[model samples]
Target: MNAAPSVRAVIARHCRELLADPLLHGDPTLRDIAAQCHQPLRVLLVGNVSTGKSTLLNALIAGPLAATAFEETTSSVTWYHGPEPADPVLPDPGHRSVTTDFPLAGRVMLGDSPGLNTLSDNPRETLRMLGGSDLTGAAAAFVCVLVGGRVDQWAEGLEELAAFSAGPFDLVGNIVAVMAKVDEVDEAVEDIERRVSGDTTATFRFAAVNQLMAAAARTGAVDDRIVATLDRLRTLPVMHGRSAPAWDRLAEEVGTALPPGHLKALEQVVGAPAWLPALVAATAGMTTTGAVAEQFERMSRIRSLEAVLSDLADDSDLFTSTAAVLRLRRLAARLKPRPAALVRARLADLTATMHTSGLHRRAAARLVRHTDVGSGLTEHERAAAQALLRWPDAGADGGGTSDRATAAEVDVGAVLARWTAYEADPFRDSRSREVAALVIETARHRLRTTTRQEES
Candidate 1:
């Protein structure tokens, strides 16, 4: 039986054809880019060491394929895909890739990337997986899984999010943030949630997830209340004429039955009280059907993340395919004994068409940071652009905020004026004139874009 080659494979094949062509035998860069393009869309689980990144993947796949410990568990880049092979496949002596029929394996490959700032070779590996170098370009989106209530840790992940940007492809547009260990910061939940939701950084869809609670409720301890809550929700009409009691209150009843330490533990890793009922409902049976697995997935928010990934897959398909075509056609045009003039003209037209397509400009604009002007923009200016660009979609896609949910808005002109009058004067770093000009222009563009979006 013949099977279709994957998008990456097609790119690789094209590269081979081009390489073997008598007319284009000299250039190797084109071959290298084709090989890099062969990489599948790798969804990275990025964060600091030991933030339950691997454990969360295990819960997501409903298997313990990723080694998990209280400390840094992932040692290298591991890729997971569907349809288990007879044995493991290692692409390189240093890295491993495996096939498993996990719920998400079929749609896209999942990569468990070590913490980007780890002490070992992990950071280098993380960058390579994300295509974060000159030789490689990104064919991936990020799921920034962070431990609860730590702005510092979250900042580290955001650094990776921004770092993924290169040239005209803005991989940051594909990021989906996950607040891990939601249960650990009970006392300051409101404040921390405020901090995260309020962050002025890039606005991307986010989920406050407690993979531990989701896993525990489904596979480990069964709190009677969790079961009870699930049963109640199942019985009621999803949109009853009247309101239903809060699910957390129902879970609290189950919490009461457990020992104080156990209850505390439950509270430590439990996610939004809203998902409690669904978590228990997920594993209420000896075996799970597709429906049950789906329910569990939603409660775990893994399904939510998967849905996001699926949409991103479509986006990735468009972006990467167009990028591949443009890259190759451009190379072919530049090759010695280049194609017929008509063929070259068509290639240029096709490349231009790809550049102007949907979301392409906005995505490219995101790469401004790689430019001298963008890098010179003050941190405040850059953040302002992020908030403005994201406000329209972020409100819709990013999960609802709690008491601290309101976006901590920024005011740039006011900030800039202060900089102008600062005690020592700002921008005395020798690029003062250049920095100010870029900052003003960037802020103006951001302001106009935001205003136009709001009006629409």
Candidate 2:
């Protein structure tokens, strides 16, 4: 028996066959798509200016690929594929920059466009690039890095994805939302995920990552333990008065393992030792003298983004199928008497694979819109379902919905009463009753946790 063909092989075969078709060959766009399919999968990094789009790209592909940045040319779109480029050309070099050299270049072609909010019509270009499935290849997906703060504050930026995604007969997904520089924020990673989870129209997969630590991890200069140690030190209480001398000395002693450069950077970044987390935040800007690539790679949270990228790469066949369908549609679009039957037949073959594609699944993302109450389902229920799906024995491990909305924000007492009613409902079927019982238990646990917080 033969092993199933790899996604790359299938995509290559599909592109070759499509290119040979006399019908599509005449169209430059489809031909370009055919040519691009032969290249590695592309993941576009799109976000507003100074949201660290270029920095994140450098972290991901190890080239200041976004350096040929900003609105030097209205139609400029920098492609970072090939053997990996030389050190990044920074300060927007006033021209396009492209190179190959860093690792994973062949496996993935990364595109870093100018910021969405740049003076150059880059956002328009970005939308065009996103809409042009042929140019980016079917396997191309996007990472929409949102600025941290109120979702309402970044609503316009988040909504930009919808506009980019908007096109007749064009269904785009496989887009992930990543919160960048999350360490600078006051919220926990999980809370940010929760708040942003309300923005259903924007991103499907949401992750709050500390790219600084991720860069550290990738650089081999720092390990998870070191990051953890830095975090611990940042929180350590500093001594001041004469009575606090011993504690102050101990705090200094604990922080000694930190690199001198990192310490200095932290001092500069934080200004004064106001608190522990502040020190931790300062560690984010520390850079290695000779290890730009590794340094950026570790802490940039590029690894988290890469996991999604790799997933998209692994599903290259779906991308290929998606691209082929789009091409067919485009060809059909150009026809006076649209070849609906012909296009449908060609597209029909892809429906099964399309359903399984990450793009389609992403399109079907379960959005938890904010109402006047809790998100209906507690975090625990979500975890239990996940556990049951993945591995039953694993169960829930401190992963559940945090019912943080106060009674003032929404009627807390009424919410609990409903769950209680469901739990005690005699008319509920046995199966439903079992589920309700579980819900009741979860609510009770949540209330207890909330009570502890209030008491503390």
Candidate 3:
């Protein structure tokens, strides 16, 4: 009766079958990579063009990560993830490097991508990038930030958000609207809050008081007004007044709005039972997974385009073929990832088919593309990709247990046991030290590896 457990059982069965194969067992790295590919959580930032998506990103990281301005910014999707910064922040896989120390929180990974409006020569490419990013995993939640502007400007964005929320990915509810740049608004913050609260269609639970106060505080401009605003935000009765709304609520709202097959992939990322309804709702209007596959294929094309652009930018000599240059710029302007709405809709369709037919291998196969195998991957990319393709069949039946499921079920008692052991003999077993060393080493290796690839 519990859809999550039922679906998970099916996934586990398939994984077991795959792991039993000798070819898969021979490569442990591939096995591990495949395991990680089974599910991943994605958090997407949704807003209108010129909204402070990038600014919020910078604020979250507490450093200048993505480019931001008062005008339309964020030309492409930028992803940020774990291992916390020890000294200075660095971009994953490729792009520019940073040198500021920032603390990290593991609750969620953040993605800042191009917004809906465009002055870019390649708007299609931008959309493609957004879609590609969506396929990477389930959108755990959406941060919908709105700047002070006519409410109508947000209509399209709200529609898009609503569509994304409709998909399976939002098993628990995934939309959180934020009224950003509140300081610039002429009305009192309370009035704005009241107005937002009154709006039933797209009312926000959380609002960011203009960071003007936070910014000023950093510079020692501590005023009573700033303190008051912060206090009000901290005490606001957003999202049913309970300390914090469960993550599932956010996941559900977004999942219900997205395209079908897209949301299932997203649902996998978010994890749990709440996703079933969202998945079912998402598939209500779709007939097949063709649309979902098309979006992923489109993303691959965009990636290829980005590769071409990077090559051309690095060396104009690379473009000996006239067709290549034209193709390069043509795709560049259309680089945004696919919309959550589209992905949600597609996912819903796929899930509906799966539920009816008792699991469709074709649909399962199609969902595989959403897995992220890391960027600028070398030998590992090919290996990771292969493992990802075979992951659905790599569980207990195949001779390996499901670490994810097991990890997900660790008892609180066991956690307490481990904590007690650590406290009793801090360095007796030194397992914690080993884990720390491994993490540090892995982070160092990742940084070096990316740097070398860029240099190459």
Error (Å) of candidate 2 at residue 10 is 5.5
- Which residue pairs does candidate 1 place in steric collision? 183-268, 184-268
Candidate 2 lDDT over 315-415, as tens digits, reads 44444445545555665566545334444444554444523232332121112111111134575433332222111111111111233222223333444
Displacement of residue 208 (Cα, Å) in model 2 is 2.6
- Residue 79, model 1: lDDT of 72
Worst 10-residue lDDT window, candidate 1: 397-406
Model 3 steric clash total: 90
Best by TM-score: 2
Give the TM-score comparing model 1 with the true structure, all chains together. 0.53
Candidate 1 wrongly placed segments (more than 4 Å): 1-14, 18-40, 84-93, 130-139, 150-160, 166-172, 187-198, 216-299, 319-456
Order of all candidates by TM-score, from best down to worst?
Answer: 2, 1, 3
Give the number of the best model, judged by lDDT: 1
Q: Report RMSD (Å) for each prediction in the order shown.
A: 12.9, 13.9, 24.6
lDDT of 3 by residue, 25-141 (tens): 423322222232232223466666766677556555455567766577766555565543322121123312233332333333456767766766423433442333322222334
Runs in model 2 lying further than 4 Å from the true structure: 6-26, 63-65, 68-75, 82-104, 132-139, 150-173, 198-203, 210-300, 335-456
